[model samples]
Target: MGQQSDGDAAVGSSTEFQIRQSFQNKEEVVLSVKDYSIRQGIEYRVLESDHLKYHRKCKEFDKGCSWLIRISLHARKGTWEVRRYNGPHTCLATSISSDHRQLDYYVICARIYSLVRADAAVTIKVLQEATEANYGFRPSYKKVWMEKQKAIAQIYENWEESYAELPRWMLGVQSTMAGTVTVLKTSPIHLGDQVDESTVYFHRLFWTFLPCIEAFRHCKPLVSIDDTHLYGKYGGTLLLAIVQDGNSNILPIAFALVERENAESWSFFLSNL
Candidate 1:
């Protein structure tokens, strides 16, 4: 009875109960709060969300549940701050229902992507169990599978963006290792008028560092060349030149990206080599 009285006092004294938590963004705040709500068996829903602020209320709002939380972006701190929280849930919450968005693809990805990346072989069952343990909910296998694919796509998209900065990256490499780096890019010819000139496209890209070239020269007179298929969004072939040193260490010399494994592509790759 004493503990119940203290709890009632805590809930009644709103001025004394402060929730000054910070979040990186509104999405983070919502996701984090959802997890907290699930773990504590508190049912709530987003009453309002916008660029500037977010408002959430107890799921039993129609039952006169006054539990509410309000968060707003702090301009100076560049973070979302909890501005208000009317505590003490009025209704019982024993389980998380399917109506909850915590199991959504985006949310699941944000929650478990780092774990998935750290252990690529982690199975869907393991992820499902982890989610249940952490957030009091278990997602279906199909949802977990879809969320995993979404996470992998986001990772590869970041890697693809790195390729766009290759020109500047090669420049920096050349600056660091003077006369040791080489980069080449070729495009198709435009045959038509001004508007069609935009159709000209990049065909191939090749890069090599002089250190690898010189290292191979002293290692062995034998050279091994191979090509592999790239499984990125823009599918292509990766051609590589390598040599084995006296100690049997494989040293890579150069690499190139071509459209396909055809004779013309092979020739273009060999010419660069």
Candidate 2:
């Protein structure tokens, strides 16, 4: 029986399985199997799956391929252990496609979660190259882009959750650092034909750190304002207020997030600034 070393389970590492190998849980077993299938350019179909066991066979099992695996939970050991394995697929490659059936967005996201978390701005081309380098196959551009989005969403909270946490985050900042200024605006929540007065939705936010505000007193009198579009699950504009120091170093003093760069939004940000 083969066992994966700690390094073998790390990001960008190769995945392989052997009979009698144990996994922490069913999810781990499934992920390793999927990774192995994708790396070897093969497809598999689940033959049996349940809370206590998992079994899979090659997609070409009926076409003379004798590849299959079975894993079951070892109640005494509190682990999932592979019971049988016939791998290193004997079936011919079905096609020359760049994509594989087992290499879906979810798998890609899991594989690249750490990279995306470390740098959310990493480009899709970079992710594609990384995937190719790791698995010897490059997925479609759209697929890699979608996978990056999912990875980001997983690292950071989803849009709805993030919007809901804005007020709490602002309060946390203010509590931790006194004199911090934060202005959060919310609109009434509307459901179908009725308005839910008790509920509110995030509309806009403006904030300036106490340190930034104090630093401005020592900086040049001139302030530069600019707005940039946000590219995420929810579209918005980020407004920034910056000032130059005596040494010509630019310092950001205030920031705001609004629906768009309109007269009203600009007015709101400027008033807060």
Candidate 3:
């Protein structure tokens, strides 16, 4: 096994490589190479890639550029090491577009994950500006929007996992807060043409905290309900019930997530409210 570096260099920022420099895994090596290629505005062709090794050469290697690199996993050391590397590109830059083929959504996700974590409502235009400032290229609006969604999934749990944990979360909330109300509705799971009676999937959830329910007693008798669409992996509607106090202050008393806004959904939310 080859010797490993004491510390792995940060991806997307480390543009230089040396023989025997190690990475945590194959993914890290590939990300670092892609970042370097994008930064230098040079294109590279992948010669080989697998679980054990990754090899790439400059796109113009045959024309004149001698740039190339080979990274292989050092099983004994539990690290991926660069086994061969030729210096910076000697050929002219081939790409002069506003976007780069190597700068995909995954790469953009890594760069914007911190921003997303700090502010979940961060806009795609802001992300695009950030990317352009850092990489000198403006990715398409669709690409940035897709990457922002990916970043949100990373910051908060993914949609599937969030849905899977709903029942547990509801139970915990009820147990920890006395007088809290939670109603979960599930539908039978379907497996292609057959219905799986043994398994069920989440359909809707209605919840209200003890404080909000108690506060509603002192508020006006009138109640207003509204809903907004959820634009995640699974489409849904978020229903909310609010009441106004004597001072005209509005307070939310109930909330629910349903499939859509319709008579049945509204009836369910109102009946529960």
Candidate 4:
């Protein structure tokens, strides 16, 4: 009988690699977990669920129990799979109010920021409500907006500081070698032949070291050119010139940054080349 019980336990236990050929509904998964809890002499509750996944926690969640599990629909097999599991509740109380496992705004902010950076048009109001439903408290619209700005700054750094450092950084680039060049043009607004406070700006920066240019003399006659957009507070474009050597190694000959990618900008970049 003891050996039979051990066999039953082994059969019921879940492994990460388990796969099922038959599909099961939410009720079936919950029943299986309920049976498991009964056998173990404990209780659990469904924390969250969607069409594709379910997350569960110990009934003692509000009392600080850390036991939890996550299950999801298997993509290939059309069956339920145990994606995660944590065992052995440690709370002293079996019932309490206010979940300890609930996520705070700081943690929510980090995730919210990531989502917004990936898709700036994501609806924060919808996210706020979703967060409230999932974690039991809603974050205010102002808080979510602040976190979005913080996340953007974290990803791109301080935009004002970046602009201020441009001149000094440009000097450092030109100090490296002769024949290198960097230019800044500010298009100031004019009112009836008088300059105004408003302005539009353009930066025509270019750089090529002596070694790179000299090395290109021995390279093949063919060249490759390309351009890419710069993701910054003030968006712009970058243009590049590259050549190949006898060993087929890529040798970058020149690079430039322009206010926009247009015929005039390309002409200016190529003229400096």
Give per-model TM-scores: 0.69, 0.90, 0.85, 0.44
Global lDDT of model 2: 0.83
> Least accurate stretch of 10 residues (summed lDDT) in model 4?
1-10
Q: Write the per-residue lDDT of candidate 4 for residues 86-195, one digit (tens) a residue.
A: 66556543323332222333434544654665676567787676555544546667766666556556654567766657778778877766655565555666679798
Poorest 10 consecutive residues of model 2 by lDDT?
A: 1-10
lDDT of 4 at 247: 96
Model 4 gets an lDDT of 0.63
- Number of the predicted model whose TM-score against the real structure is largest: 2
Residue pairs in collision within model 1 = none
**Which of the two, 1 or 4, has more TM-score?**
1
Residue 121 lDDT, candidate 3, scale 0-100: 84
Candidate 3 or 4, higher TM-score? 3
Q: Would you list the clashing residue pairs of candidate 3?
A: none
Q: Please say which candidate is ahead in lDDT: 2 or 4.
A: 2
How much lDDT does each candidate structure score? 0.69, 0.83, 0.85, 0.63
* Candidate 1 local lDDT, residue 91: 71
How many residue pairs clash per model? 0, 0, 0, 0
lDDT of 1 by residue, 1-273 (tens): 111111111111112224777776776676666655655566677788999999988778778788888989999999988899887676777454753454466556766676666675678898887767756678889888777666655554445565666677778888898766564565646566434544445467787887887787788888798999987567899999889999999998988888889998888778878
User: In angstroms, what RMSD does candidate 1 have relative to the true structure?
Assistant: 8.8
- Supply the TM-score for candidate 4: 0.44
